[model samples]
Target: MSRRTPYFFLLPAIVFLAWFMVVPALQIFYYSFLNYSVFSASTFVGMENYRRLFADVNFWWTLLNSFLFILVTPVLMFLSLVLALCVRNLQRGTKLFRTFYFLPVITPIVIAGIIWRWIFAEDTGIANYFLSLLSIPNVHWLTEYPTTIISIMLVTIWRGAGYYMMIFLAGLALIPKEVEEASLIDGATIFQQTFHILIPLLKPTLIFIFVISSTAAIKIFTEIYIMIPGAPMANKALVSFLYQQAFERFDLGYGSAVGVVLFLITLSFSYVNIKLIEQRG
Candidate 1:
């Protein structure tokens, strides 16, 4: 019950986090300056890895693709907010709709990505099968760069929508009913109520989603890895670049450089998330 007792209780978690997270993060920065693999002795290379990375044509392209992934944030926000509104206005089956949409959120990402890869298969996949019925030819869903990124983005959106929708639903619930009723009495149209009233009140919720979702977009790895498993050259993104260099190629120093960059990029967004949460008061 003493103030010091609270610190004693928290000590274990603090120690665990520092050892696991902080130590590895520091190691990554330290190792990035070295030129070595797992088997070889590390030699301090003085930013040689970064110089090479910057010189690599694929690195710039990969960086662009990583930013491209940020597009998912706005798309997710729109879909989730719209779905939240729809569910809120429904007369019944609210639980059913919520459950159904949220089902994908519970499914394991690797398993879902594997199923989606099959569904998007060029010739015999269900996605193409449906398109066939509509007289649309099979479009290469996962093969080409453009479609590959788009397919991954779609999967991200589908998997994320239900969760964000629930958050929006919570935000909607917090709004006072009297404000809505007052708006209705003022003869505001649905569009007017949404743009003028609901959106303004939901600014905090929207920004919260934006920060978290943007962070996720930056760290995108699993979906691209799963979908493009066989095609290493085509897999161009910050994390993908890191994986290929560090794990696949066994160039630990080069890989650590990519990791450092990825860490910095994700760290900035994480800082924003923390700041937003603090200011949320």
Candidate 2:
């Protein structure tokens, strides 16, 4: 085989990455330093956009909201691992259960959001109807402050858990049966086996899921956009804030600044997670 064969095979992927990922990232970075709005002429005002972004109180709030939203990651990870473990040992109907759980993952986020929005509707929604049966007042799921954020988090968990479950299932499959049998022979409880053997072995998979889910939580926009259409202050996520600034308000430079900050945050989180996992290992 020619030494150049590997490069030939990699060329397509390299070109795709350069075009789709690298180029767009560079453009966003460049735009973050300028006063580029959709309606006006572009002018380079180095650091001004960043300065403005730092000074904006709402931007800081959005950042806080983004971090708060990431609280869903733990819930997602826990549920996914549990479900994966449950289905991993199933002797029958395993495929059916997996398909049922994963249906929400393949469902369009827009459609999911719409369905959830109606389900949680303030007046006539199913949630309130159930509450009414219990003599409780109609709880505002989306319009309320923390509840609005919580609603989105719940939707995120519902959509993401099964997807991550598949990752855990694959990791579980890679775990040697001999080790499990040895643990069983040693009279280890399921909990003990999971904690001592399964979890330790699944570290890499856990870290990957953590990073991916954290990033997804931070960059959450579509669900918020569709579920809470007008983006009330109580429910606004960082990406939703950026969308309003860039598309709705036409402040592209500021929006790009937000994007850069979001990128840095996600990168930092992923790095820290991987480092922590490595240190633990």
**Cα deviation in Å at residue 105, candidate 1?**
0.8
* lDDT scores of the candidates, listed in order: 0.89, 0.91
Tens digit of lDDT per residue, candidate 2, span 1-281?
99999999999999999999999989999999889888889999999999998998889887888889989999999999999999988899999999999999999999999999999999879989999999999888988777888999999999998999999999899999999999989999989999999998999888889888989899988888888886564358899889889998999999999999998998898788878777976
For model 1, give the 10-residue run with minimal summed lDDT. 229-238
User: In terms of lDDT, which candidate is strongest?
Assistant: 2
Q: List the residue pairs that clash in candidate 2.
A: none
Q: How well does candidate 1 score on lDDT at residue 36?
A: 86
TM-score of each: 0.93, 0.92
The true-versus-predicted C-alpha distance at residue 274 of model 2, in Å, is 4.4
Off by over 4 Å in 1: 1-4, 232-234, 272-281
* Model 2 C-alpha RMSD to native: 2.0
C-alpha RMSD in Å of predicted model 1 compared with the true structure? 2.0
